[model samples]
Target: MKKVLITGGAGFIGSNLALKLIEKGYEVTILDNMSKQIHGEDYTKSNLYRNIEGKVKFILGSVENKEDWRKALKNIEIVVHLAAETGTGQSMYEINKYIDVNIKGTSELLDILTNEIHSIKKIVVASSRAIYGEGEYICPNHGLVYPEEREDKYMSCGDFSVKCPICDVTVKLKATTEETKKHPSSVYGFTKQAQEEMCMIVGKSLNLPVVAFRYQNVYGPGQSLKNPYTGILSIFSTRIKNNNNINIFEDGQESRDFIYIDDVVEATILGIEKNEANYQTFNVGTGVAITVQEVAEILKEKYNSNVKIEISGNYRLGDIRHNYADLTKIKKLLGFQPKINFNTGISRFVKWVETQNIENDNYEKSIEEMRQKGLYK
Candidate 1:
């Protein structure tokens, strides 16, 4: 059995991936700090923590610590780095924390591998679609173009469409490929971009195989419902369950490519098992863009809730207007394709949410934090 070390292996994706790896007969070990934000205050008793507890070797430590990386890498043949501070809005105010954990922590792991002899054969780091920012858009006049961050002046007036950089006219949203120019709009995105580039650059120098998976908006069962900063699906469900009104940002037309958790897990597995994935970055998404309005409506219908779906003109500074992955590369190389469509995946997720203890809605608190920072308007 191949021994694999998964950093942040106790969280949603990490816990699920760890379970899958164990089922496939791989010896798994997890290193995680178990943040209260994701796991709640009684973290040891949380389902995410309990699910993997005693199932694998668990090390409670921070990836920011070199000693933690040193201890976790022992006898490991593969390393799946999933540890990082997420939430784009929070990252804007908590800039130092995001950079320290995402970029500096990743550099620490690479430093250890560069200096010390380890049994590691493969490394898989989680990148985000946020690195693509506004992504690619086609202009009638300018052809293909990457738009800059939308100005607050325009967004303040309810104009949310991304425009052509050259002509300043509205552009069409195109699937963002791995080759898309990365000009991240948020601090979280900037750190992820740095992390991916650094790993690829250092991996080539070390002659070591490294694979970066640029995961789209991943959602499904086992995701953190308590966290209000990320995962809109979870956030909406919690509010609906609490009989609170659902708030949709922008005009409710702003969209994202939501990929199911199982599909994301399968893609990561392919990246780990396939030699074609070596020294490359693959976008892990279903390639279907779903609007925020649609998501809110679906969740409300599925849950049989009477809560109002408010289309708030509220906008976040670093939020993207639209972005979806182009999966041609991963499909051709790894024979990987998403099996779970949005409808089916959302149904399964709602069922799972019904069975769990409904978490208290802290959505407003998180938004208030951003509002105080002047990031949320």
Candidate 2:
């Protein structure tokens, strides 16, 4: 069996991929810090590593620590870097934390790769769709345009449309192509873009195969129900389950390209197995865009909860209006297609969520933290 090292192996997507690789006859080793934001205060409480007990080697450490990387990369043939602080809004305030973990941590890993005599031949990384910023759009007068971030003045007036840069008219949001220019509106997105670029640059010099998967909003079973900063589906599910009011940010029309966890895992697996995905970046997401209101309604109907859904006119800094993926590259090259629709995926997600303890949501508190930092408006 081929030996693989997954950096954030105990994370939402990493944990799932670890299990899938194990099933496919690959020996896996994980190096994770198990950040409290995602895994809670107790690292031992994580279900991600617990399920794969004795089946894989688990190193409880951070990628920022060179010692941890050294220990984790022992005899590993493949590397999947997934350990990073992942909160767009929170990243705005916690600037140092995001940079240290995402950029510096990735730097340390590359340093290790550059100096160390490791058996690693292939590597894959987790990039975010946030890098695309406002993404692609089209105006009737103009042909095709990649929008700039919407102005707060327009947004404050409740005009949420992304306007054409040239025509200055409201443009229709289209699927973000991989070739789109990356002007990340968030610190988190900036760090991810840097990480991907660093990997590609260094990978070429070393002749190592690298795959950067620009993932959209990934949601499914085993997501962190406690983390209010990320994963809107889990946040809504937890709040609705506890009869708490669902606070929808911005206009309810703000949509995202959410991909099922299984599809993400499948794409990652393809990146690992296929040589065609080498030294290339592909966007991994459902091509379809679904509104935030639609997600709220789906969960409300599924749980049959009486909780009020509030579309607060509140907006957050470092947020995009609408962005979805154009999966043409990944589909044509890797033969990948998303099988689960939002309805089926959410149904499965809610079933798994119901089995867990609905923790006390510090939703307002999390928002308060951002508000104090001028991130939440």
Candidate 3:
């Protein structure tokens, strides 16, 4: 069987990807520190764990430690680096913590793989859309702009503009292509940008096959709903399931390109399978932007519960007004397309949450109290 090493394999996306690979008959090895509770319990007990529980090897350790990485990389044919301190607002306060895990950890992992692991040929590192801070303004004809708002909604000043709506303001909202100029807004984004640059420079210098994926909002089951700094869908779902009001920051108009977990896993596997994926950075998203209000409505309809929603006028600092991926390059290069729609995916998530008896528990209460205490502050 083809052996693959997946860092953060116990986390939401990593665990899902590991299961998908196992289903495809690949031998999987998971490396995780178990520092945080992923989903609800240890990664070993996550919803997807049953799929690969005994079949895969689990290494408990941190990526920042070369000894741990060395043990994890043995006989590894491919490495999928997904481990990172992935919080935007939280990173603002914990800058060094983010740097330790994302920058230093990734650097250490790469150094070991390049110098020590001889069998590993390709690596797929997780990058983020955050690298393109706010994005640039372009004319409706896809021409560059000089500080003015672009015409395309996808490329515009609006939260979710894709193309120019008017003839005169025919500029496209600056959609982030692989070549788009990077200006990360948060410390998390800056670290991710650094991660990509490191891969580019080191991979080129060492002649290693490296691919970086700039992911949009990834959500689904097997995510830590208890963590405010994690996936929004899981967080909202947990709150609503426990009969707590959902809080919406900055009105309900802020839009995001939310990709289902399954689609992301599929794209990741494709990135590893295709030779063209090497030395490239591709955006992985549905290329469809949906507002936060739309997501709440969808969840409401799916759960058949009249969950109360509280809209706070305050917005998180460094939060982008709008974010969606341009799929032109991903489609052209990897023949990748998001198959699941927002409503369909949300329905599935609702069904899963309904089965978990998450009402009035300590975890639920603590989250509610935290929100009440303004822990998000």
Candidate 4:
């Protein structure tokens, strides 16, 4: 069996990928610290573990530690590096932590792989769409495009503006491609860009095969609803299940290319199989943008309940206006396509959430109780 080491294997995407690899006859070993707030209480009993129980080897450790990575590298043929601080808004408040984990942690992993893990042939990295900050540019055939661009346009200003055909109107925000520029607006995005750069530099210098996947909004079951810092789908699903009011930050017009977790895992596996994916970056998304309002409506319809949605005028810092991915490259390169549609995925997720009794007691108290019960072991 092929030995694969997946860091952050207890998290959402990592765990899903691990289970898939195991099913494909790969020996999967997961190295995760399980430090997220929601996972702190029942980290071991998390939905991830429950789903992939007894199928893979689990190691309790952090990617920030070099020794942990060195030990995990034994007999490993491929390394799937998915461990990182992923909160976009929270990253602004904890810049050091993001850098330490996302950037520095990646650097350490690369160092160990090049120096010690000579048996490892390929490394797959998880990147994000936040790298492309708010900017507008002209694309061939697509006309002018503006999704996360800055608010103040040169033409919008009174003077020092040139009037052009593509300059006046906002173009249809097509899915972003692999060729998209790296102009991250938040510290999280910056760190992801740095991580991709590190992978490129190390792969070129050491002659190692590295693939970086720029993930869009990934959501499905096994997400931690208790952690508001990650997974908007989980947060909203939990709130809707509990009959709590859903909070909308903006006018609900800001859209996102929400891809299912299964599709992300499929793309990842295909990336590892296709030699062309090495030393390259690809966008893993559905290539379909949906408004926040549409998501709320979908949930409401699925649950068959009237959930109140309150729109908050204030927007989070470093939050982009809109973002999506162009999956043309991955499709052409890997011959991969997403099988799960949004409605089907959401329905499956809602059914799974309904089974969890998070509203039986206060959220904090229940989490503490689970901790006392020793579910994290």
Tens-place lDDT per residue, model 1, 107-148, is 999999899989989899999999999999999999999999
C-alpha RMSD (angstroms) for model 3: 5.1
Between prediction 2 and prediction 4, the one with superior lDDT is 2
Q: Candidate 3: where are CA atoms >4 Å away?
A: 39-44, 48-51, 139-174, 359-377
lDDT of 4 by residue, 40-109 (tens): 4766666766776678888888889998888888889899989999887667767799999999999888
User: Distance from true position, residue 89, model 3, in Å?
Assistant: 1.3
Per-prediction TM-score:
0.99, 0.98, 0.86, 0.87
Task: Give the higher-TM-score candidate: 3 or 4.
Answer: 4
* Candidate achieving higher lDDT, 1 or 3: 1
Model 3 residue 78 lDDT score: 91
lDDT of 2: 0.91
Best model per lDDT: 1
What C-alpha lDDT values do all the predictions have? 0.94, 0.91, 0.76, 0.77
**lDDT at 80 for candidate 4?**
91
Reference-based lDDT, residue 213, model 2 = 98
Q: lDDT by residue for model 3 over 44-142, one digit each (tens)?
A: 555555555676899989989999998999999999999888877667667899999999999997787567646888889999998886665566464
TM-score of candidate 3 against the unseen true structure: 0.86
